[model samples]
Target: MEELAINGGPRIRLKELPSRRDIGSEEMKELVDVIWSGNLNRVGGTKVSAFEKEFAMLYGVKHGVASTSGTASIHVALGAINPEPCSEIITGPISDIGSIVPILWQNCIPVFADVDPETYGLDPEDVERKITDRTVAVIAIHLFGQCCDMDPLLKICREHGLYLIEDASQAHLAEYKGRLAGTMGDLGCFSLQQSKQMTCGDGGITITSNDELAERARLFADKAWPRGQAGDRGYLFLAMNYRMTELQGAVALAQLRKVQDIVARRRRVGDTLTKLLSEVEGVNPPKILPGVKHSYWLYPLTIDTGIIKATPEEFARAVSAEGIPASTGYIKRPLYMFSILKDQATYGSSHCPFDCPRYNRRIQYKEGDCPNAEKVLRELITIPVNEFYTDEDVNDIFRAISKVARYYRENPKA
Candidate 1:
């Protein structure tokens, strides 16, 4: 075996990984247009509306509401649904807090469901198990560019009479059985955050087929003002100012045009890496079930530590030292394990709503709430796969990972 790079041995390729958010002349041109037009805000601007329309059309949705951030998009989407106050929304435990913050902000309960051990998506059976009459919706977050299995989830939502919202923040243009990730649910939200598969620095959009829901989202996004009305009494409901500026819209529009290329390249690099890793003894690749098309935002994989005889963190550090960008765990812990949620840290001590009488049920978050999610977070490693990587870059990744795994396998006690 080749000497380990971390131990003063010949190393794999030392070239830098691609920069995040590959902006070019296209993005520059869009920015220039935004400045020249001087219509910065979405209130009376054409860029935001145009981007919204085009984005919605991309997913075959009827309407799209642009917002300031991914979290704001979720907030507006939830407000549009206007579920019974203090009701519960079920979601996966392993995802960005952005997926659940809107629930807490809306004064609603976020009940977490365990994820599939292989796919790292919500286990549909577990989601069904967690549902109660108080459950009004399910936010299926497609983590790491793969679409969560939607058929069973959709059936469960339909039977339970709950709205299904697809959190496609990481999954841009991903497909489950040929249907787009965001298109499978009642409402689909995408974040064009800087690190996502697509980006406009920081922005988000919510898409829906329901005209009424779309209108409500639009109203909620812009402070509940009636758009283009005859009378001056425009306030229909108290809502947030989650508007996206035309500049962001312009950049997002350009990004949207390039999304297909980005997603395809990521898939290519990720699949190649997966095949390469599969040849290694203990490394597990991100699972892509037969028909599901993963966009590969970040190539997430789990190590079979039983065979590797190395912890996730150790493996990550060794591989990173070998010049591959890898890390152990996605977030610090499962969403529920966070101090804010576990200790009911909301509204500063009051825990209002959680402690409020209106909800009428005592709520508590526990560490064991989603066991599978907990296990995965502790055992997973994330390797970023950007679109800018060439075939050579992918080959280097394969060599780096293979070398690291071989060293670990041979020195189980080390």
Candidate 2:
């Protein structure tokens, strides 16, 4: 048997991975138009409005409300829903804080449901079990570029008459069954952060087909003031100034033109890696559901500790030593385990929605709130996936991972 790279042996890969993004003339052209126009704000500039129209058209939705960031996009959705205070918004435990923070800011309670052990998305059965009279909505966060089991979630929400919001921040252009990721729900939110498939440095958009919801979302994003109603300064209701600038829109518009191709290339790379990993023992690739298309935001894998005889951290370190980037446990803990949720840390010790008199219930977040989510995190090891990977690059990843796994198989007690 050969020595492992972590043990001072030769590495499997000698060069860094290829660049994932292709930002050049197309993006520059859009920016030049915005710069010469000299209107950076969306209200007066054509870029942001045009971007919204193009994005909405791409998703087959009637409206798209642009915002400053992914979190603000969620907030726009929440504002559009206009749920009563203390209303519960059920969502999965495995996602960015952006998915949960909006519920709190809207004076709503965030109820976490355990994720499916395989897909790592909100388990429909668990979601049903977590629902209550106070529940008004469900935020189906499509984690890691894969769609959740949307059929059951849609059925559950329909039967209960609750709003369904798709947090598709990591799942741009991902598909489930015959529908696109965001179109499956009442409203869909997306992030265009630098790392995402479509990027504008940092931005977001929410889409919906319902006329009322669309109008509310548009107004909500711009502080509830009716745009183009000259001489009227009436503020409609409580809302935020989460508007997207023309600069971000210009770049996003250009990125939008290439997003489908980018996602397709990433799918090829990710599918190739998954096929390769299947031959390696003990390590499990991301479990994609039937009839689902994963956009491959980040390639996540897990190890059977009993067979690998090593912790996720140790295995990731070994792979990284082979000149492949890898990390253990995506977020280190479930969202509920974080201080912002567990300690009820918000509103200057008031805890606001959680502690509000209208809520009238003793809500407590604890370690065992979502057992499946916690287990998945413990076993997860994340690796980078890029659209620009060549056949040789993909083979390098396979070689490094297979080499490390084989070393552990030979030295189970090491």
Candidate 3:
């Protein structure tokens, strides 16, 4: 057996893997048009509106509202939904805080449901159990570019009269049961952050087929001011200014045209890694659900402590030492465990949402709220998956991981 890289042995990979993102003349061309026009704001800019229309058309949606960030996109969705303040919005526990921050900002209670062990998505059963009379909506976050099991979620929401919002920030073109990630809900949110499959530095967009919801989303992103209405400066309701700049719009439009191909390439990399790692003892690749396609925002796996004789952190370290970038526990802990939710640190100790009179019951978040999520975090290992990665890059990753797993298996105590 080959000596372990972590123990002063030669590394499995000698050179750095591909990390460059796809960006080129297409983006530059769009930016040039925007600059030449001298319209940097979406109010009079062509690129942002064009990007929105094209994005909505791509998803077969009627409207797409562009925003400043992924968090802003979710906020736009929430603002459009117009949930009663202090109403509860249930969502998966394992996700970026962007998924939860909007709930607090809207003065709504952010309730977290545990994730499915296999899919790492919102568990419909757990979601149903968490519902209360105050529940107004279910924000189904398609975590890690894989759509949640939406059938049961849609059913539950329908029976309960709850609005379903799809936070598909990481899932650009992910599909579930013949439905795209963002189209399966009342409102769908996406991110254009630099790390996403497609990006415009930092931006977001919300899409919806419902006409009223779409109009509301558009207005909400621009502070509820209807810009197109002739001679109407009518500030409709409480909203925010989360509009996307013309520059971001330009890059986003270019990125949108290339996103489908980008996701396809990323899928190949993720699928290939899953296949190569399938037989590697003690290491389990991501569990892609039936009829679900993962867009591979990040390649996540788990280590079996029983068979590998090493914790996820230790195993990740070993793999990293072999020249493959690896990390344990995507978020270190569940979002609720963070002081923001656990300590109710919102509004300068006001904790308005948690302790507000509008919300009758005292809301609290603590450990063990989502056992499966916590357990999954403990065992999860993540490696970067990029569209630019070549066959050799993937093989090097496999080699490094295989070497680490073999060493841990043989040593029994390493």
Candidate 4:
């Protein structure tokens, strides 16, 4: 193996984000104008109402309830289902903490399951194994902007009478087997954070086919008071304020119109990067499962530590040094790995149905607990595949990654 040296050091950048407002300046201005005219609440507002209607129609869902954020959307959706205390909600370990936090907040136990190595989504078999009489729901996260294998997951949920919640925060407009991601589950949640393909600076939406769920979601996000009920305007049920502002809704509505184009651009960049990465030694891009259209929120590539001289962390730092931004690992492991699980102040010590002390004390994870997820996390390096990257930028990233990979392969000592 021969090292590839660069005369001017590394050359690629990790992430070059696009301006959400840049893609839709005119529409964004219109939204700002609406906000300027004084309407910022979801209640009795045209922007909020229009956004909900348009978003629902786009996802092919019967109803959409806008919320403050993706976490709030999940919180409201989970609240609507109202699972019994200690009921198990199955989810993968690879997702953001927000997905599982809502389960804990709702007084439900989160059951960790392995993810498919190729898809990085919930493994139906693992989910089935984890299911028990106490299991009440399943949250299938569409990780990396690709929809999970929903057909089997849906079947598993249906057989066990489980509510399937689709966490589509990173997968807006992604499709699985011809159906949109959020529509396949009992309820779907979307994020409009700044980095997301569709953004409202900070906002989210929950869509569901069930009319009752939609209505309850609205109530849950709006201080638990039933909407449009006669007489009492005061809060009824105990609920947190997770309402979305009209301005956020307006920006989101405008952003939604360009979601398809944004997704397309990201896909193109991801495809280019994938092709380039495949040529590099010890690097493998994420595999696109059959019948899935990936929206490519983040193009993650795994570094084969056995074959490569450099560790994932080293590779990421080297990439960054070359001007490309890269990261080695994800946030803290599954919720079970968090200190909050042990603290009596949160969820209490004995709240876990399992051996609480043992669960909290044990740091070593089982081999198969989250096998694929663990493997990916250890070796994966992600580069942003946002709408901002141009063809030249993709080419630069490709050249830099290839040079680094070559360098590490030859210099086994370093």
Q: Tell me, what's the RMSD of every candidate?
A: 1.1, 1.0, 0.9, 3.5
lDDT of 3 by residue, 139-193 (tens): 9989888999999999999999999999999999999988899999999999999
TM-score, per-candidate, Cα-based: 0.98, 0.98, 0.99, 0.90
Tens digits of per-residue lDDT for model 2 on 1-414? 778889889999999998658688999999999999988888789988899999999989999989989999999999999999999999998888999999989989999999998789899999999999999999999988999999999999999999999999999999999789899899999999888888999999999999999999998998899977888866899989999999999999999999999999989999999999998889899899999999988998998877888888889999999999999888889998898889999898688888899999978999988989999999889888788999999999999998888888779644
- List, residue by residue over 291-338, the lDDT tens digit for candidate 4: 888888787777777778888888877776676777866653544456
lDDT, candidate 3, at 6? 85
Off by over 4 Å in 4: 1-24, 234-236, 342-368
Q: Which lDDT tens digits does candidate 1 get at residues 1-414?
A: 677776777768687888656778998898898889877887777888899999988889899999998888889889899987789999998888899899988889999999998899889999999998799999999999888889999999999899999999999999999899888989999898999988888999999999999989999998898877898958899899999999998899888899988899999999889988899889999888778988998999888877787888888877887888899889969999887688888897678668878888887888888888988899899998889999989988888887888888888643
State the displacement of the C-alpha of residue 267, model 1, in Å, after optimal TM-score superposition.
0.8
lDDT, model 2, position 245? 93
Report the poorest 10 consecutive residues by lDDT, candidate 1: 405-414
Off by over 4 Å in 3: none
Top-scoring candidate (lDDT): 3
> TM-score of the candidate numbered 1?
0.98
